[model samples]
Target: MTTAPFEFFELHVLRATRISPGFARVTLGGAGLGRLASGGRDQRIKLFLPRPGQQEVAVPVGAGTEWWPAWQRMDADERAVMRTYTIREQRRAPDELDIDFALHGDTGPACSWALTARPGDPATVLGPVEEDNGGVDFRPPTDADSVLVCGDATALPAVAGILAALPPGMPARVWIDVEHAADRQELPTKADAEITWLCRDVPPGPGGPRGATVDGQPAGAKHPMLEAMRAAAVPGGAPYAWLAGEAGCVKALRRHLVNDRGVDRRRVTFTGYWRRGTSEDDLIRQAIAAAA
Candidate 1:
C-alpha cells in the first residue's frame, strides 16, 4: 500500500530569539500548520526563503519524488533550498509553533538566515514527520536492562527532547558531543538518565567533531564515544542504544555498539545526521535519491 504524501505549511516567522551564543529559536505560525503531525522529534522541514527583493514565489511541498518536477521548473536562484533540522519543540494550540536552528558561523543558508532572523520574516514551513528510524518509537525498557544514547550538536535537540520526555525513574545513560564547554546546556529529564557532555576545544574536523577521547586520543581511536559509553555500566540489562551524528562517526559507533558490545541490532538506532563536506540540502538530496 502506498502512503499519501504529507502537505506543506506556508508560514511566517512570528518571532525569532537567540537562545544561546550559537543557537536561535524561531517561532512560525500560519493556517497551514493544521497538517503538522504532533510531537515529531528529529523530523526535517523546508523553509522557503524569498530572494533579496522578491515578494512571493511557489515552492515545492509534499514527498520528494512528486515534488521534484515543480522544484525543477523554477530558476536555480528562485528555487527554494531545503534544509533538514530536528523539531526542537512544538505547540499546536493557538495556531502552531516550532523552534530550531544552530548558529555555526554562517557555513550554510539555514545558519546564515537564522543568525539574522527578525520578527515577521517570511519563510514557508512544512512538516513534523517521522524521520530516519521509519517512525519507530523505542523507549528504554522499564524492567529489562540498560540504555545508551549518543549524539553530537546537531542531534542535541532530539537527545535533549528525548531526555526531557522520558518517564520518571527510567534508567538510561546519554553522551553528547558539543563544540565547546560553554555549548553544554542542562537537559532536564524525569528519567533516571545519566548524561555526559563531551566538549572539544579544537574546531570540528572534516566531519563535525564527535569529540576526542578523555585521554586525548583521536575520534576513531577505539571509537572514543563508544568506549566512554561502554565504560558506563548499563544497570537494567543490555541497554537499547541510540547513536546519531556525522556519517562516519555514527557508522563507527553503531558498529562498535552492536558488533563489539553485542547489542542486538534491533535494539539500536543509528542515524547519520550530516556528512563531511556537504550541506543539509545535499544530505536531503542524497536521502531522497537513496529512497527512490
Candidate 2:
C-alpha cells in the first residue's frame, strides 16, 4: 500500500450541537473529503480555524517542510489558528466527520470558536488522504489479555471510539475524570469494561473548566488523575494501556505504570493531548527540543 501525503482541505460546519455540559460536537463536510476513510479510533487531525472576526481561514498552500517557516513569517493578522482534534465519528456516504470540542467559553481559541461556530462556518483541516493513515495512536497487541484506558474529559471522544472498536466482550478498565456530573455522558461500548467516573469537587458552570481538578484534590494540587489511577487496580495479564489528556497527567500515569506498577513501558501508548496553561506553539517547541 502506498502512503498518502498529509494535505489540507477546506471544510465548513454542516452542523453544531451541544452534546454535554463540557462537549460540543461539530460536523464538517466539503469537497476533497472522499479520501478520508475511517482507519482507527484515535485518529488525529489538525484544524485551521479562522481567527477572530475572520469569515474563513486563509492558510498558505503547499504545506510541507517549509510550511511552518512560511506560516511563522506571515503577518499575525493573516495567520490562522491551528489546533489538534480527534475524529469523534465518520460517515462515508456524506463524507462528513464529527469532532467533539471541550467548550471552556472564551478561555482558548478553539473553545471560543467552537462555542460560536454555526452552520456554514468555514474551516480547514490537515489529515491523511488514505484510509490506512499512520496517525492513529491506539495500537494494542492482539495477544494482550486485557486493556487499561484512562483520560480526562478532553479524551472522552477518543476513548468512546476506541471502546466501540474493541472486539466483543474484551476485558477492559476505563477511568475518566471530569469536573462535574453534567460532564458525564453515555459511553456505548461492546467491550466488557469497568468504567469509573472521577468527578472533581468543583461544580461545572458556564465559566468553569471541566477536568480542571480531580476528586478530593485540594486547590492548586497536581497529579489528581495519577492519584485516581493509582487507586484502581490494573487489569490482569499483559494488559495494554492507552493514556491521554493533560500532559502532566500523561507523564504521571506513564511513570506510575512503568516505575511502580511494573508494566512494561513498551506496552503503554500515551499522548499529551494538551497541557494546562500552555499554547500549541509551546507544545510544538517542546517536541522539537525533545527530538533534538
| Best candidate, lDDT | 2
lDDT of 2 at 162: 91
lDDT of 1 by residue, 103-217 (tens): 6554577776776767777777655443333333445455546667888877887887778766788787888776666667778888898777666654445554446533343
Stretches of model 2 off by over 4 angstroms after superposition: 1-4, 64-66, 201-221, 284-292
Clashes of each: 4, 0
Compared to the true structure, candidate 1 yields what TM-score?
A: 0.79
**Would you give me the overall lDDT of model 2?**
0.79
Worst 10 residues of 2 by lDDT: 212-221
TM-score of each: 0.79, 0.85
